[model samples]
Target: DGVNYCTISLNQHIPQYCGSCWAHGATSALADRIKIARGAKGADVQLSVQHMLNCGNVGSCHGGTVDGPYQWIYKLGKRTGSGISYFTSQPYLACSSESRDGICKNADTSCKAENIARTCSTFGEPCVGLSEYPNATISDYGSIMGKNAMMKEIYNRGPISCGIDANPLLKYTTGVIRGWSLMQDHVVSVVGWGTDPEEGLYWIVRNSWGEYWGENGYVRVKSGALALERSCTWAVPDTYTAPEKNNEIHCYEGGENCKVSAKDESTAAAPATRKPELWKRDEVERRGFQWRGNSSTPSSHELLFTPSNGFPETFSWCDKDGKSYCTVSVNQHIPQYCGSCWAQGSMSALADRIKIARKAEGIDIQLSVQHLMNCGTAGTCQGGEPNAAYQWLKEISDKTGSGISYTTGQPYLACSKDSDAGFCKGVDFSCTAENVQRTCATFGKKCVGMAKYPNATVAKYGSIQGKDAMMKEIFNRGPIACNVDAVPILNYTGGIVTAKSKDTDHSISVVGWGTDDKLGFYWQVRNSWGEYWGEQGYFRVQSGALALEQDSCIWATPKDFTAPERVNLLHCYEDGSNCAAAVSATELVVCVIERPFAGSPACLRSPASGSSGMIGSMFQAGWGVCLERSVARTWESFKKPENHANNWEEAVSFWAVSFAHELAHFESPLHDRQHGRAMEMSQRAVLPGLARVLSKPWGSAVGSQNVVHRKWTLQGSGGNLLG
Candidate 1:
């Protein structure tokens, strides 16, 4: 009873306009019922509206009765118990017999064999009909009238479709519409109902015009407004063709090299790049990114999850078991308001997802949406698509090993190429190496572009819609970006938002979902409007009220976004030629010495050794010389009471003289000139430090040196006797 079983939302006018609201409304409601019948478990099953348009002879783009699809699908299932195909098999084409728009002008809107269940080739081949396709069956269907009947049907089962007079809803933005009319022209799904103390009773309706219209593609109209309660259609879901594997055929434009079960939107061709654009203050003074409509195709892959204990009644990435797996809230309206809601929403969700991937253990990894605006990969300050941003980042990750840089590398300026709305106007939005990351010396010193920097990439991304679908994604992974009607939310101060949408022109992130004892189900959203506004930069709204559960929802997977190691070590080769090559002096080098050494304690233990202490000399490796181990052996002998030296100072002086003599040879080859210089410096300079002699063996060199008699004080930090 606490579970959500509703499926994703639908838009009939995408990829072009089509007056197929009747089919969309019917299919969506049927899909929701199917999900409910299935116990709200596994992935939500969606009924194909396209299949209804292609085969069901009820209505076309021009419109038809609300019960057409339900009645037709029910009859079709009576034969083999197989009815309409799944949306994955036959996606919405926005085409029908009675209407045409965009690419649909030349589309085949027929009930022909191929049109019934079709497939196109990715390599430019003729379209063909599929003998086998996944479909959902409707066992029973009927019509209902009156307010009480509609509410009971929905509450007992799922959503129901009904015809409504939408003539007065053209300008509807927020709040419950109160007018009533009997002339029906459009159809929509009534998901549920709620009562507003001030506005009285209302219906939570899901429209087919996409999330950009009427309270995020939904409208809360008075119970009897526009004859909405006059009549409604309901369907009982039967057995659906639930295949373990995806067998649908996918093809590129012009069709040919079609592949079976390739419904992944991530693999689709990337959108064409656009040039950077700047807008005037008056042109984009409202919002940076307005609704450009969804250009990306819907993803067919639904994440399959089986929770061991089911989902919690309330869960949030912002507060999961006392730890917040989310980043701090960001303000997109800073400096001034910028219409980059697309960037702000998408980037914030991405950053939160990255935080979730890292287990919120270390420093947070916040992505730069400004980078998207500057590079013109996603969109400009004028407007763009949030879903497209993920695709662009994925493209960058595939081309280069890196994706978008961190916010520290490139902070948000809220300016485009020509926009003058804020102080950041005229700011360089160029896509250069320096623009990506830069470093400068102190004060007025020279500055240079950085070659590398921290970044996060997208592994795969896709779109999903509806309350349950959005909840599953947030619960399984992290947060998600979704379009919402900003009118009611903009003035929101506190409490749950019961007002519906006009146009979902604003974008925000859905962090999680919770059940309000008084308000019922609500979405926990993160806004980019700053913490000073609306409950600390966030607002809770009735789920699906502003079409927040619609197709405008997009999510991405974080790839290669983990934090870097704490310390970076420089590995030196065995030759020791490139010793301490880094610019920083503090760099630690792990030098490996695999070659054999000559002057070892084992060799010196023999009495036949010609030298008392071997001189440090240059090896075959350039820039570095080997210091014989004999100096350490000599120092060990002096430290003990057994060897020669008058007192402690004399004992230290004997060891110091031996160390200086060998250091001199190491600086130059075993030459007398270097030895004389070292001897002079040892006598003149007073070096203060305790040098610990290392007993490790060094290469053999033929030389013997007498210990010089001079008082020397060596006491400091530990150091190697030989270099």
Candidate 2:
């Protein structure tokens, strides 16, 4: 049974599937599409086909030569599945015999009684549709290696006979689905091979099981051809003459109406259809950097999600490795390739999350990559509520939104699953808060005679009163939010104490007391170690008396709130007094803000210089001096390698910080009493970028003089950058 193995090898190489083989005929190509062919039982067996045949006794070969030469037809193969049968003729191949004079003689053997081999290949392909091929061509097909190997292999790769066409009628063309491999004595046609950098070669061949296989899903090829050549099968095609439209064709197993070519006997090389050119239609590049596969391979349960209402805000994390990287741009409804590709890089991925959180109820949040970075900073105040975001979120949300519906002020924060180990990448805020004492904890304020403001609290003095006596100097200056807790105060009373004071021990301490609205709001006042103070140390007066007597105040609400302003001042004395009657009056302001920085030294500043009016001077002078001092210290801090940053991104961050410290001084005349000696320049806009030329090696990192911020940003920075 002569079979066309060449046609089988023509169809097996693509990325999708593999072609397995059964009754051996030198298993060659890969099987792509799989389908049901025939056979009732499913088991494993081997089939043996006769490899040689005597064609009218031309002993050495065919071609009407000596004694009707004997020739090689198809080989045998072993396969797994049900039963077995031998295959007959298929039209995809053709054969021509060579005379002793080396002439390939074509016989009048076209299956359809015509001269051309149309059914062998689509058109413009090799000759086909015949039973006996010259032994030389058959033997030559075996020496080939891989897709890129020897010249013999190169000969098998032209005309791509294996790709799946759109035609539904060409089903069995792929072979595996046809169950033709099940035949015991059957050998079939050849297809193609696989040469992906990964898996090598599989096979593709045909059978007599109608057109059910449609070219795929039936056989298996020897994995790498290492030891299974004995299982190879082969075939030959009979050229069909009458052509039919592809749509009108049916599942015919043997419509072999084709013919062999006259040129088969030359043994000369076939002309290649292409030539190398400098210009190419495809691009090639090096791919060495992929240490791992380009994409991440997460665990099975890993899923990407767009948080409920907090899309991009709430990111789902499935760890492929131990590190915490965020896939913030996930889309919950569709797989990543649909209306959703990984949404990253652009502003939409992050900013959108923030806008979403703003609309949600419960908590106010800001969750951006930057937000994550902020919360993760070794330096953020967290609105003075240290270590509280998580707990605060817990408190705000109703259980319905507990897991995630709770919102945020900023949505695009780089987020990952909250691990039990804690977000290891962030700063330990709880620890930082507990250690606040290490950063600043010394409450020691001092006052004498009379303070400038009404809300003064002397560690030693209570609200003293009367003319030129020890009690008169007690309540003077306004309270100081200027220092850390306004502690360590100096009391100026040298009088006796009484019972109500509880011996907090001071010549003049307010100690503590009850307020009576109807009784003029009394203050339980205490006095010095001398006189017989009210029962061991104190006495009470109307609540309103404290305000009138010493300039005390009410606790103020937030600026936009409806509560009354605390410490609302009523000037004690003014400019209408006669010269002889003029007594000194002190002006004090109790502020609600804490000192901005812990160690920024305090200064007793006057109104700024060069300002035209008294009001302007008062507004700027005292503050300007303090800021000048702060700028110098910041410059010094940037000198060390550990602190000297080179990037503009980081430089801008520092600029904001430095500006903040300066604003602190501009607004409050006395505060943060700590680093005055470090002054170099008065403000960020004023500090020269890249310190003085001569001091580069020894001096601090000063800012650029020409880089003042924009008017808007400047306005917020204590309103200075503009003019």
Candidate 3:
């Protein structure tokens, strides 16, 4: 035989009992090939097996087939580097038993797992390290059947992955095992083939188990034995260039680039001359007062009125002077393309009003465009009306205390790089529903735990008919929702846009107005295409142009809106006894626990008052009384006291004492006097009530009488008190 040489072999060990032999075997072979193709000049690249195990589309920790690893590499590509870390980069926790089966479990057909295998200086630092191997992909891959073919591939391409019967090789030592049953259940790589004087012919196979298990991490197996070469695969690497370091600042105006077209409808020439039409006052009232026109008319608002007496010459909710009254700036419609302008327009305007109503306190709230997009009855991505979105918001707000959430809570998901029409045509409505449902559930849980603004309603909404009226409304409120012919907006980059059309197909917000000597009078408008587009998510349109004030420009008044009042309450409990309390301006809730609060530290420390708790201990904060429940059968003793006690006395004692203590802290002149005076005042106010309750014949007989009295003294801080 003339062929006996093999490329210098590379070996790897997938530590622990991970069932990701498929990932290890395939990535190891590919890494070896990449090294050989690069002339083996630098350190051998160790492709991440853990990366494939955690982030790949292949099976999980349980054993998987070689085909899946190859398919994942061919599809999503692979990252070449060491094990970054557990979970943060590459997770390698393996099932202790063989009961777990390996299969891709992600719901979506596409693999959307975040890439976490890049090198980093710190364990969880967001930055990917420089030492990480360059990104690489398998250009082409094919199976090599038969022993000679597998051996030939190894000889030519450094190493080839092949399926093997792992049972007979489990306890393998130094020497080659001659014959074993051919049942392939695991995968390994054949790095070389050689003939021994005593063993005859053998294949040098690499194992994923650490070096301590076999002959320095490798095994010399009898050629063709144990189905070692029954099936094998070889792949060729594609030309790869290391990606440029991404150092660009991710501003609100930076995101996926919008496509520009030469024949973009937004910038196309206007049709031959057309006359503007004006609706009569009665007709406008009947049709919801939406404007539809291309050119100006005597009846038009711009022609019929002047700015309100106090309207500002220039104003924007989002201005460079740091006086932005609007909550959110830019947003995107992505993942799937959706025609959701109606939803975006209404939600954006409403969010601005909410910010204005709250006087821009704390962080700006970006209302959920996705809420209206998925739950509203207006229309799907095909197209919709802003009025329907508003009506839907009103109805939902009445039904659910929280009608919409912020962008961080619900986020826009439907995205398309193409036109709104194209996006709607290609979307899967069912999938969109699933995405919204899953996100909303999480939002509901977190929202209830925080101090949320009261649910708001649209008290009054009307179309702004004229330019003066629109500007006045915006100045008085915050922003106004309006319809515009969006054909020219598709290609808008910057500066004043003066294009006009009779057909208004999109809804947007008119945030403020300004004057530009060269570009003429314009309105600062916000688009839902995200901040990366236009001037940091905003653009300017010539005032009274583009049907901006046509058929309907609407503004709403927020009703029943109230801000959350700041309040603090303390819970004091015995070392082992479970007693908890939450105090807000409107309510106080007390709970006696049978078990530990199984929630986050913050939730446990300050549990929301209305949330469900143990039966007898659960009551609204407005009850103005404290509840004491026991885990054992000691309730009969307490029930007897309630029968003879004046309920009003208890309410007076509890709230008067609590309020006195809170006020002492609020009005205290010295830090040391805050807690002490508050507690003393509280105890003094309730002393008479406490004396009456303790004087009861049953209370005197109970051994726990002293405990109840001690509870009141320790009320200001966390402690165990009698009672």
Candidate 4:
């Protein structure tokens, strides 16, 4: 209750070990939230109860035999939920030096089996031991129970339809499959039969087996949550009667230019009143399934909602104009209509089609990433509905006929949420590595390709243009090449500055691109992300017919502008000063009017410090700028070694001498030289020496590759040299 720690002094007192699971350092804010939310304290304790549900539901669906949502407080009886030690927990043991994998050499160092397992796992593995459990089939019995209850109030949807293990051994067990749920391979559990904590009313609670699984399964939730989630297919039992599907009229029916006569339509209206259970759309379309095409609109098929318990009462759709019930149009992008009628008994029709495709394609595959990406906005995914790609790939894998142990001629398709528009790019799509080659060879192009929509797009990056990226002045904003041309706007392209991958080469990334804009675009593009360079790394392209497809843009500073012109020197001024002393020592200030897009210009001042001194501007400005002042003796020493210019080079050797000198100030390496002697950094020991502005050139992002250099110069002792 007392003030724990002072604001400035708080960081020093963090606890040594976490007090709970899936957490980080002891004192993190997440730890505090969990302490308050779950009444526990552990950094990252924010990995909630619902999130834990995945481990359970996923466990039961894949590994565990029994399942049910026993409360988080119940299932995780002891907070330390136990599991296969290698996957979920690490043993508190030391690895012998010989068994250390050469990663740890000392006795005090350690490595865990969890880390070892991670190293062993691949992207192909989503959850471990997925194939060990029996694959589940969706049961339609639940829907029948719901229907019987609706019409006759006979609600006996017990064990045969949906049952809980309910065994004493499985009670309060985490891995027990409590009951079937909506998602395929998705299962839920019954926590307890008790009054709702918030509602103060009796209810049966369920949990998702995911940490964030329920509202902690806390509400007076609806009955048959899984049934609703699964969207159970509705069909009448033998005892109940309904018209046969074959008797239903369809738009694409036999040899007919049929139109519903006014008299026929009026007669059909009588059925809705007689049945009282029929949907309105069904009644309207009863005369015939012939929908007339409007003069200005595409033909539309009215949807009839057919609920197992009753008829669909309404329909809806979205058009370009945002109308809920849209008229079908020429463009296929808009929704023509939506209705329970439209989908009436649609699930069965789909099931039949899937059975055929599965047998023909030999691809009765499971639900996966490919199914979702190209889902075309379909909200949920159910297996045995159309998944041609998954089916095709699964067939190919099966064709190889190698099960789990036999990772053979072809590897089974791996799924991921990252795949674009629902297709696999294969681990080695570009023929870059051996695995890619193996994958491609085994699958053929289609096997190594996307499953759905044969022509669906896979990658989205625009191709690169010219080579070496260079900073350029604002005036030359064109497709003007950089590396081979003038100056650089940004760093040379294809740079691997901050490597994120274990493979150093993969660290390379495209930094920025150039365009043919007269001025930098993003004039109004402002964001808190990073500094602006052609609208914060984004450039504009001409969209009209004749405009060329522009890919990259690079800019450079004119080498001539770095130094003042003879005329400009005669004008007599420094970066921001004017020197009047003819032969006396004085400070010379240097500055650059930055090219707003790329690279920093090096500006060095001379004389270190001066008294009563007004020096001329050291550099100039024009197609770039020209240097100022007549003191030719002061500015020449820090140039480059000009002998070897044209050949490709390393990041260190090829760095321009002038650029390096500027980088000296930029990195502020603790120089052995005379300048910057009095500079004091917060942690002088932190930086070993001056930092390197660049590490290596992996590729180019904006400009060209070629560059020109300047030779080094010298002046009197103690005199400042501006390169």
TM-score of each: 0.40, 0.14, 0.38, 0.17
Candidate 1, residues 214-294: lDDT per residue as tens digits?
A: 554568988778899987899987767532233222232212122333333234442232221222234432343333223
Best by TM-score: 1
What's the count of clashing pairs in each model shown? 25, 148, 28, 89
Evaluate residue 104 in candidate 2 and report its C-alpha lDDT on the 0 to 100 scale. 14
Candidate of highest lDDT = 1
Please identify which of the two predictions, 3 or 4, would achieve the higher lDDT against the true structure. 3
- Against the correct fold, how does model 1 do in TM-score? 0.40
lDDT for 428 (candidate 3) = 26
**For model 1, the run of ten residues with the poorest summed lDDT:** 584-593
Residue range 1-111, candidate 3, lDDT tens digits: 222122212212111124566766777677767756654322223454555654565675556777777777766653532222112122232322222211112112222
Every candidate's lDDT: 0.58, 0.21, 0.49, 0.19
Q: What ranges in model 2 sit over 4 Å off?
A: 1-186, 195-201, 214-228, 231-723
Residue ranges of candidate 3 with Cα displaced over 4 Å: 1-310, 330-332, 398-402, 406-409, 415-456, 560-563, 566-723
Across 493-516, the per-residue lDDT of candidate 4 in tens digits comes to 111112111111000011123333
Cα RMSD for predicted model 1: 30.2
